[model samples]
Every structure is written in C-alpha cells, then in structure tokens.
Target: MQGTLNEIDIRSILQLIELGQRTGELFVEAHSGLTNTALAESNRSLLSSGGFGYPSPAPQPDERFWLVFAIDGRIVYAADRSNNNLLRLRDYLRFYQVESALDSTQVPLPSANPLEYACLWGLMENRILTPARARNIIKNTIEETLFDLFNLPQGTFNFEMGPALAPHLTSLEISPLTAKIVKQVQQWKQFYPLIQSPNQCPVVTDRDRLQQILPETTLANLESWADGKTSLRQFSRYFNRELLAVSGAIYPYIQQGWIQMSDGCDGMPTAASEADPFGIAPLLVPSEQEPHQRAPQVVCLDDDTTIGKTVEYMLVPKGYRASALCDPIEALSQLFREPPDLILCDLAMPNLDGYEICAMLRNSKTFRGTPIIILTGKEGFIDRVRARQVGATDYLTKPFGEEELLMLVEKYIGLPEIAPPPVLPSE
Candidate 1:
C-alpha cells in the first residue's frame, strides 16, 4: 500500500501494519520543499503554548530517504538511505575499539540491504561484538531513525509485502517504540532555535567561562567532546546515550552563548582522520637534499573515467597533485579524509549528483572555505543559479580545455608554483 503522508501519517500507517500483522519493508521518501512556513502552520499550537521557539528558517535534513524492515509487524531494522556508507557503522565500531576488524574482513557491497547492516552481522560472526551488544546497537539505530521519521512533516510511503531482512539480531514492537520516540521528539522541539539539529556540532566558544564555572573533570570532558568537529548525534553514539540526553546536556551551554553550534555534514572529516582506513596518502616530493614544499592537491570527481583522467592529466603536469575518482562514494570518503586545496566535481552522476555533494561539503566546516567548481555539460542560467545556491565557487561547462580548467583553478588556489632547479657547482 502507498500514499502520501498528509493523508495518513506514519503512526497510523504503522498501526495498520501492526493490526494486520504484515511483514515487509516500508520505504519512505521525504518530500522536498517542506518550508518553515508549513512547519510553523503545523505546530502553531505548540508555538502559541511557548513549548519551543522555532527558527524562522530551520535547517532541513539532507537525508531525504529512509527504509524500515519489518517481520510480523515488528521492526527488524531501519536506516537512513543517505547514510549507507560504512562510515556510520565505523563510528559505532569505534566505541568498542574494534573498527580495525573491518579492514581484515571483506564487507559485502550494499545491494538490498545497507552495507552498515551487513557489517553488523559480520561483526557478530567474527565475535567482535556480542549478541547482546549487537542487539542493543540495532535498537539504538532504530530509535535514532524513528526519531527523524517522527519529525518528518510530509513524505511518500509504500509498504511492500516480502520476506524480512536476513540474519536479524532483534525485533521491536512499533507502538512502544513510537510512544517513547514521540515524547523525545516533543522534548527535542523545546530547543528549536537554540539547537536546530542533532547533526549540529557544538563548539565551546567561551572556554574561559567554562573553566571558571565547571569543575576540572567536567571541564576536561567538555573540552574533549566539544572540539567543534563531532556532532551531538555522534556524541550519542560515542557515549551510548539517547539523542535527547546528549542534546539536553549541551543545550544550556548553547543558551548561555558559551557554546556555539555549527551545521554538520555526515561522512565529513572528523577529529579522527588518522583512523580513516581508506585515506589517500599525499604524494611525496622527490628531492632529499633540497626539500620541496608539498604541491597543491586537487580532487576531481566524475562518473566518466575519461573526465576524471582528463582533469588529472591537465592538472598534474602543472606541478599540482591531482586525484581523479570515478566512484562518488569512494570520492566522498577520500574527500573527508583529506580535503584538497580545491574540488572539481561533475554535476551529473548516478546515486549522488554534484549539487547534493556540494551542499554536503558546504555544511561542514572543513570544506566551507574550499573552492568547489561545478563541472557540467549544462550551460543554462538556472543550472548556474542552483549551483550557486549550493555554494559552488564557480561553474565550468563540459568540453572545457586545459586552459579553462587551469584558469579556474588559478583563480581559486592560484597557479601552482614550480620551484627552479638548484644550480650545480662546477668542479
């Protein structure tokens, strides 16, 4: 069965599934253009009651799709479609200090199931995580996913009948879970303007004030966690706490102006870059006697191998180090590991397009200042305007020449400087 959320909300749909004891997957895709005006209208009563102060324009989620697997009307698993990258799984594994186990095992490529879900079973099989621990992780993951779903004001959903997800750890009843999440969602709304998203990274703005007010141990913990890189959601995973608890702990500091929250992008580079297994090592310069400075790094992402190679061929010979990636997912992983001096992104690609990628990068602090040039075949005015909206530094039409590519690069990072060779002494 399929319908728009406005006709039948998520709670009612789930209730129907439970009443019928149906087993299958429920796919939900959030409708784009859900403006703050709509949200304000829906929550007008709450606003009048003064339960929460909504931001004039709240931050919308980049994760627009979600999948929930069920068996006999019980939730088997749920995940955000955009977070299919192994990064979320890796973050969870880090809590157990067993993230290294992933390197030795071959993770199955994501197909019907997310890579993270598959890896969870892999971890169980390897004995890296006990069954009880795995079950708890699954529960927490489902809870977090449900929280987001509950907040979704409008979307399209379809429940398809089929066999359940394989190798399930545990199943949860929808009613109890829904009840718990509903209350948490209400509390979450209380910090509306102060804390927009769980994805918002909390940075300690007034360290001196915190030092004076907080105890030594409390201050140290705050310093360690509030490093301006990890988000409140990540903190929940790291501490194994509920999203509300993590946000609540930091909400006061946010209100006091002692902590400032910044928008966060999932899979963006964090403080733990060193632990990134897929990180691309910087190219080494050859002279030992006279150490040369590191060359400016440029990353070009395009599904067309030819386009990637063309960009690399054009840039590398100009004393710049260039890495071309055909796979958008791998490219994002590498980009997070080491943000290049500049990024050249193709506008059209399967799965993730350039606009979405650009928006994701702009959300993060790391790539906020980096130049992002959108490379596309389209030269329409609308395309350029859309690109600009997502924070593209410039737009370059396809079939661009070496000079055109270099000119844009030069405009942003300047021309790569090749040092003059040292003079040899005559014997």
Candidate 2:
C-alpha cells in the first residue's frame, strides 16, 4: 500500500498492517514543499483506490527516508536511510562493551540491507554477542527508530510484500511498542522551546551553583557529560537510558539557569570515546623541543560583516584559525594564494553568488577535494540540487547557531586540539 501521510497518519497505517497480519517492507519518505492542495488530491486518489497501490517513484539522493521490515505484522527491523553508516550501530555496540569486536572484524560487502544489520549478524555468527544480547540490541534500536518516526509531521509510505530480513534476531508487536513511544513523544513535547532537539548539547553554565546544590559525585558526572560537545541523544546511548529520562533529568537545571543548550553535530565522538576503559593517552604531546602544531584553518565569505564576524567569533574560541571575508572577489584571490582547510561561502552576493564561487573552486585541482559548504536561507530542493551539482560538499541554512557552524566545520576538517584554558590571577 502507498499513500501520503495527509491521507493516513503513521499510527493508523501501522494498525492496518497489524490487523491484516501483513508481512512486507514499508518505505517512508519525508519530502519538503508539499502544498495543501496537492495533499488533498493525494488523499482523494488514495480513497478512490481503496488505499492500496503501487509504490511512488524512487526518492532523490538528498531526500530523507526510512525503512521498516516486518514479518507477520510484527516489526523485525527499522532504520533511517541516512543512518546507514555504522555510527549508530557502533554506538549501541559500545554501550554493550563489545565495540572493539567491530574494529577487528571485516565488514561484509554491502547488500540489500543496511551495513549495520549485516554487521550485527556477523557479530552473532562469531559469538561476540549472545542471541539474547543481540535481541535486546535489536529491540532498543527499533524503539529508537519508532520514537523518531512517531514524531514525523508528514511523509509518504509504501508497503510491498517480500521476504523478511535475513537472520532476524526478534520481531516485536506493533501496538505495545507504538503505545510506549507515543507516551514518550508526548512527554518530549513538554520540553519544547526550552529543549528544541536531542541534538542540542547541554553545557553547564553555572558550575558554582550546581556544586552547591548537587552531590559531589553528581556534580562531577554532570561536568564530565556536559562538556559542551555531546548532545542529549549521545547521553542516552552512553547511559543506556531513554531520551526522555536523560532530558528530563536536565530540564529543571536548564530552567534554573545552571545549564544552557547549544546545537550539536552528529560528527562528534561517540560516548565510547569518553568511556574508554584503558584511559589511552594522546599520540603526541607538545614539548619545548618540538614546535606546536597549527590549528585547522576556516574561511567564511559573506557580504554582511555581522555574519562574517559571527562565524569568526564562534570558531576562534574552539581553537580553530578562522578568517571572515566581506569581499568575495578579494576573498577568491586570497583563497587561491593560501587555501583554507574549509570554505563557507554565502549564497547571495553582489558580484559572485555561492554557486559561481563553488564551481570556480571545483575547477581548480587545489580546491577540488577541499570542503566547500554553501550557506543560504533557501530550503528548496532545486537549490540543494544545484549546490550539489556545483560540487558543494554540504549546505547550511542562514542564521545558524554556533554549534551548527562548529558541527559542519568539524565534520569536514575535524576538531582541532583544544588548548588548555588560561589560568586566572589570584585575588
């Protein structure tokens, strides 16, 4: 069956599948720029056809989509298309203290299923994880996927009869899982406006106040986890707790002005890095005999001085060498002379637009592989397609937060080695 979410919400769709005892794969795609009229027409068409039809056209590469595998009306597995990277899977494994096994094993070649799914089976085959442990992991993964899917505002869905995912660890009933997730979703909405997204990193703003109120152990735990880099979602995985539990614990502290939330990037290191049992040291430490290494260089090109300075202000504090250029023409000349590690070009400019700048950079072998991110206020699909065509590595919307800027830069060039904070003079 295929139809727009406007015609039938995800909850009703799942109910229908469960009642019918259907066994197949369901594909959901979230699209932008759908009008009310278009949605009405889709609903009418679906009603006339009795709510079952062929699948829609394939989704574009940039579109966000998800897949759920079911057997006998029970959920076998679900995954976000963009999260096919083993990062999410690695996070779960790390929680179980078996992530090292992944590093040692050769990941099987890609198949119809996600690489993470394949890796899970590989772990089971090698006895790295017992069947019970693998099943538990699968259950948690499905719950996390459902939590996000339940919150989707609109999308397209299709279900096609097919073989179940191979080597299935377990199949969970829909109603129970949906009911639990729905409650969590309701609670999550309570934190809205104050805590916008799970990607928002929690930073302790008033350590002195916290030390006075919280137990010494609790305060230390807060300091370790609230390092201004890790997000609430990562904390959930690190502690093996639900998202609501983690966020709820910090909600009051946030309201009390002891904590501040900032946008976070998925490129940050996983919780396992912070939980390393061996306490591994850095590869190299600077000494008087050796020259200090240079920080990652970043350049921002924008006609607005305020935006340019904002970029510089955000990055410089994080140990990056940042320069903001107001003149695109002169900026191009300087860039050619000494190419920065990453370039952030504004979309609208007087003489040179971001597209032209990106194309010009792509032509040169020096900047061909370098990361060029187009910053714009536009959210249309065509603009994104054009940016990709011009060899722009990524796109960021305007009026972005500091964490958003840092996240993109880190994703491309990686975080610089942070210098120790300067000590203050005694009173």
Candidate 3:
C-alpha cells in the first residue's frame, strides 16, 4: 500500500484536512498519508498492511520529494526526502505527529536537538556558512539527519545537494524550527537523478561532477566513506576482497589524477593521485623518494625531560631537530611569539595540561594556523577521539615506537622540499 500511494492522493488529503478544520495534529507519516479514517477504523486490514501507523514513504531514491506546508489556508513552506527531512520528520513523528497533532504556538524546537538540524544551526553560528549557503546546508543537514534517524540504507543518502532547493523542500527543511502553523503535504516527484543515481550517494569528490561520472561506484562507498577518512583501502575492507580489486576499480581515477600511491608503495592499493577523493591536494604524485632536507624540528614542552634527547638520538642525520623546554606554559607562549613548523607537547604538565594548551593555541589568532600534537599516557579509541575533539592534529600514546612518532609527524608537516625552480629556468 505504501508503494502504491502517489502524488494525487497526497494532494487530495491535504485538501480534505483544510476543508474539515479538525486539528488534533498530524505527524511525519514516516511514509504515509492519513489513510481514510475507515482504514484506521479497520483493524485487520491495517495490521496486515504493516500497521496502524503510517508507512515511511522513501522517495524513488536520490530524488527531491515535495512537502507542502500551509498555515491558516495558505502555503507557507515545502520540504523533501532528498534532503532527508522526510526521515527527520519520521523520527520526530515516532513520538509526536507533526501532521495530525502539532500545537505550533506552544511548542519550541529543542534548544539542543539530537538531530542534524542542530548541527546545521551550529554551522551557521560559527560563521562557517554564508547567505548563499542556506539551501545546501539545510539539504546536507537533512540528509545527515535522515541517515542517522532511519539508519537508512546508505545508498539512498546523498550529499550532492546542490545550490538551489525547490520551495516545497525548503519548507520541510525549516518547518520543525519555526513557530507557524504548518499545513504541509508531501509529493514524490522525480528529478533527473541530480548528482547521484536514482538510488545513490555522492562520493565527496572535490567536484560534484565525478558522482555523475561513476554513480554505481560512488553508491558503493557512501557509508564506508562517511567516517571521512582519506584512505580508500580503509573504505573497501568491508567488501572482503583483496586490496588490488578496489584499486583496480578506481584505477581510472588514479590515471586521471584523482588519487595517489604513497612512496614505498608497491603499486599496492593507493588513492587516486589527485586525491580528489579526500578533496585535498590535486591529482598528482610527487617523486616517490625521500626529499633532501635540513631536519624535522621536534620541540618538547617539558623541560629537563629525556624526551628531547631520545628524539635527538633517533633523529636520522639531517632528519630531525630536537629541543626541550621545562615550562609548558612558557613553551606555548614562545611557540606563538616565535614559531616553528611543528610542535609536540606533553599532556600532563605543571602549568597547563595538554588539553588546555591546545584549546588556547587553537583559539589564539596567531597559532590558529599551526598544527599541534599531544603526547599522552592515556591512549585508546576514546582518548584519540577526545584528542581530536580538543583540536590536536594527532595523538601519540606514551611508549610509542620511534617510527610511529615520525610517521605521525610526517603526515602533517609534509616532506621537505627542494629549492624553487630557478626563476624562469635560465635557458
């Protein structure tokens, strides 16, 4: 029955509700329109069709769904499932029917919502977005919200939400946050399958165009890529295949400079050279060799500590510069006043713990651009999570291997460079 319902019935029901003026409230059907009251009255038939409740009407995949919102007999807004707002309303409707039972004047949107909408608000507060951004952010937030709420299969989730939003979709996007009486109706209309396939997600490509270039493959990676890591191998381990298969699948991308294989890489699985996948760096592989360099600078915040000497001993000739400081507070101050390319600090310090220092540095206008590492005895997934939360670029547990530490450092500071190409390359 859910699959059978179409646009005409949805509009017809909205007309009926306005005509009747009966206002207990209605919630997100999840996927239903109010079946006739007779359908509700009949217990056996409804039960067999999967419920007394409404069906979750997923749109025909990666397409816009229109939700018309009217108040006091006039259309006020619209939202759609593409933005995942339909799913959001589905979650909220599980407790309170947005359609059948809303008391618009009395209720307030949660001050702290457990949905993507809340994070969207946060994104706005940070000035990370602009006026031209509302439509896309709302769509992305809704998609994000729906993905979480329904545990919706990832393929149907998309981030290719473009610059313009239809009026109906925009209405649903903002409905739950407003104080107006919302008389809305939803319609599943097909788009030309916008950025992804009819049932696919976008690949976070530097350009939205690539999703069009490789729809099926993009759909395959949505959930696995959501953690937003740079490594493609990490995304495909879920497929239970050898690394080469995944690499071969995306090899065209590498040739096009979409990813890169790392040095010491034996043609093993590597990202496209351009790394357009990560949306960082272009599709180009640097020379696969260690670079000529002065030394990697490693500054330890705890003065009179053995860390500096140990690092220095491990330093390959022309590979590292190790220095120590007794006072973390002073070191932090000095770091900004006269900075190096990288900083490593102990988490447990006398004047300020690693977290506090990191916050200060991150908040400081001068050090805002610098990357800081934390050396902590506390190390676990949770600890690493917290380290990232506090803005540490990377976390190193106590008793770490020398190689582990350097690799972590290298990943950020980047390899050393040769001198600039002699201006204009004298012929």
Candidate 4:
C-alpha cells in the first residue's frame, strides 16, 4: 500500500491500516521542497521576529527526512531518521529528571530505532524508567512522531506487509490515539504564529527587562528554561505540554524582546562536522567517556583477510590495540575472551553472517549495549534497516577510507590522549 501524504492524510492511513488489521511496516520519506514551503508559509512571521528569518524562498532540502512505523496493524513501534524521536526521548527522560540514569547507561549502537532500545535499557532492563513511566514516554514519543508526520505537506509513503515487530512491551491502539493526536496537531498549528520550529532553541534576552515586567514566578521559569540550552521541542517535553502551548506561553516574552530563538539545544550551536553523511549524529559523546591511559580495544571481523588486516593497520598506529578475524565463528569466542570496546563486522560473510553474529552478541548481557558496527558493501535503506533489526549499531559501506574508519572508531571508543611519549626526555 502506498500513496502521497497529500492523497491520503495520516489519519486516514491509520484508519485504513487499522480497519484491515494489516501487519507490516510503513515507511514515510518527505522531500524538503514543498514541505519546507508549507511550513515557512505558516510560520514565516515568527521567523522574521526571531534571530534568523526563514529564507525568502526556503532553500531546497538537501536530504529527505524519513519515518518508519513498525506495526502488527496496532502500531507497536515508530521511529524516524530525523533524530526527532531520539531528541524527544532524551528530553522526556530529562523531563522526569532521569538524565543521570542515561548518563551511566550504555545504549546499543545502531540506534536507527532508538525509541525501542531506550525503553529496553531505561524501562525494562535497568528499571531507571519504570514501566508506567516508560508508557508515558512512549506515548509522548509516538504523539510527537505522528504530529510531525501529519504536518508534512508533501511526502511519499510505502507499506510492506510482513511479520510484525516482536516482544513489544507495549502497544498503542490506533483509533483513540489518532483522535487525540489529531486534536493536538490542530491546536499545535494555532501556535504557528509564535513558534516557527520546535527545533529552535530559546535564549533569554535580558534578565533586567524580564524582571521589570514579569512576575517573580514567571521570571523564574524563564531563567531556568531559557538559559540558551533547551530547544522549544525539549521545553515542551520537559513540561509534558503541547509544543504550541509552550510556545504560546512564551510568546509574550518573545515579542517583548525578552527571549530569542536559535538553533540547537538551549541555544547551543551545532557543528556541521558533528553530523555524518546520513545526518545521524553519533550518540556517543567524547567528553562523556573519560580519558584513559590504556588504548581502547577495537576488533575487526571480515571474511576478507585484507579488510581485517587493513583495519588493524589503520588503528594500531593511532594508540589502539586492534585485532582482526576472518572467521565469524571464531570471532564470537574471541570477543567473549577479550571484549573489545568496539567491534567492526563484515555484513556478507560465510559461516554465520554479520547479522547472525550481531544478533548472537546482542543476546549476551555483556555485549547487549556494545558498539557493533557493520561493514557492508550495500548502503541501501532496507539493508541499513536490516542491520539495525539484527542489532548492528552502525554501518560503513565497503571501500571506506581510513579517515572514515578512524572517525567512526573515535565516535564509539574515543581517541586516546597520549602525551607525546614524554618528548622532554628525548630533547
């Protein structure tokens, strides 16, 4: 089943699938052109009032945004390639003041479907986020995903019927959930004049000006929230309020020149260098991982002996202890014997393919959250999705350069802080 979002609204699409009790996946990819124009048309005034106005004619979107629905016709799981869901999940966790829990918890690598794994680690596995809390988080996440999808002015969707996602800890009924979300989306549009994009981060303009006219309580809220680090999307999640509602509440301040919107979290700047070719930012933060004296371990697994050898060659000189295995069967045992901080496995291999190896490793408690990057010749969307399904954390296409490999490795395990081998002694 397939059609443009214009031909079939998301609500109708939901009802149609629900009525048929279809079991499969729904994929939505929205191109930038018309979608951006529609969004800008609705909220261009807000943009003009802020730090950066929307381009007169918004530039063409370089890359398409995507959303995936994992359903047994009941909507068991939903994910997006835009990082919107992931950001929402993070803000939702932080909204409940559970940021510290995630700080210590290690998330699996291929977070192409982060909402599912976050629930596993935060809700069921660690109990950091209780089942009940997890449910609310899931609800908010799904709501946000749907809200974004519904608003897309133009997009193509494809549904492939197959076996449904399994072991779902929770499921959302389509009928009522759709109704509630539809209402929320309507209300969200009402705030368009004030909030241009949820991605915009809010920053306080002047404390003195804010204090002069605003009540103490309201002023405090602005101070705590408008510290230039929280995006409007995050602000909404933090309060469990609709995006529009939160924007409306702060609209007065914005108009009074007491606050302004900027890009990134709480007005933090985003670096283009931080984003990968696919636009997915590495979930691992370098500062989050403490520096250590010993080099981090990295293991490369590929049936092609040269590929493994090349990985070792590239990593060894960079202060890493690297090893390579041509046999996937032996790779598992070797991984268990000395668990490397990161593993790179070839996707297509003889005697237990990379997917099987990844699935096997993920089954183990120790490696469940380990970084398992797939080295593949294929870069198609389906192949990447399959890699995620089998628990591969990330993928690098075959014939990748040394810099690509190093960047990925650094993203996961981080680069060692070597002190130049005490150069003073040689001098």
Q: Which number leads on lDDT?
A: 2
Per-candidate clashes, comma-separated: 0, 0, 41, 7
Q: lDDT for each of the candidates?
A: 0.72, 0.73, 0.40, 0.65
| Pairs that clash in candidate 2 | none
Assess every candidate by TM-score. 0.55, 0.57, 0.30, 0.51
Write the number of the candidate with greater lDDT, choosing between 1 and 3: 1
| Regions of model 1 farther than 4 Å from truth | 32-63, 108-112, 264-427
State residue 185's C-alpha deviation in candidate 4, in Å.
2.4
Model 4 lDDT vs. the true structure? 0.65
Model 4 per-residue lDDT tens digits across residues 1-427: 7667778877888888887878766656575334433433423332223212223333344534443455545776565543323444556675556755665676554332334444444454675764445645656667777877877777766666665554454566687788887787777677555566777777787889978876776666566666666677766665555666667667777877778876656333222121111112222122213232345788999989888878877777776777888888877888899998899989899979888999999898678557899999986999899999988889999999999999998776656544222211110
Ranking by lDDT: 2, 1, 4, 3
Worst 10 residues of 4 by lDDT: 272-281
- Roughly what TM-score does model 1 have, to 2 decimal places? 0.55
Q: On a 0 to 1 TM-score scale, where does candidate 4 land against the true structure?
A: 0.51
Candidate 3 lDDT at 226 equals 32
Q: Is candidate 1 or candidate 2 better by TM-score?
A: 2
Report residue 8 deviation for candidate 1 (angstroms). Answer: 1.3
Tens digits of per-residue lDDT for model 3 on 1-427? 1221333333333444344432211222233333544323332232223212222333344323332333322232233323533233322222111222222222124422223333333443453432223333343333322322222221111111111211221323122322111211011111221311112222333334445565554433432343233233332222322223344454454455443333221212222321223222212112223221333456767554677555555443324555667787678767866676677877778768888888888786556545688888775677678778888888777777778877876665543332222222111
Arrange candidates by TM-score, descending: 2, 1, 4, 3
Question: What's the CA error at residue 314 for candidate 1, in Å?
Answer: 72
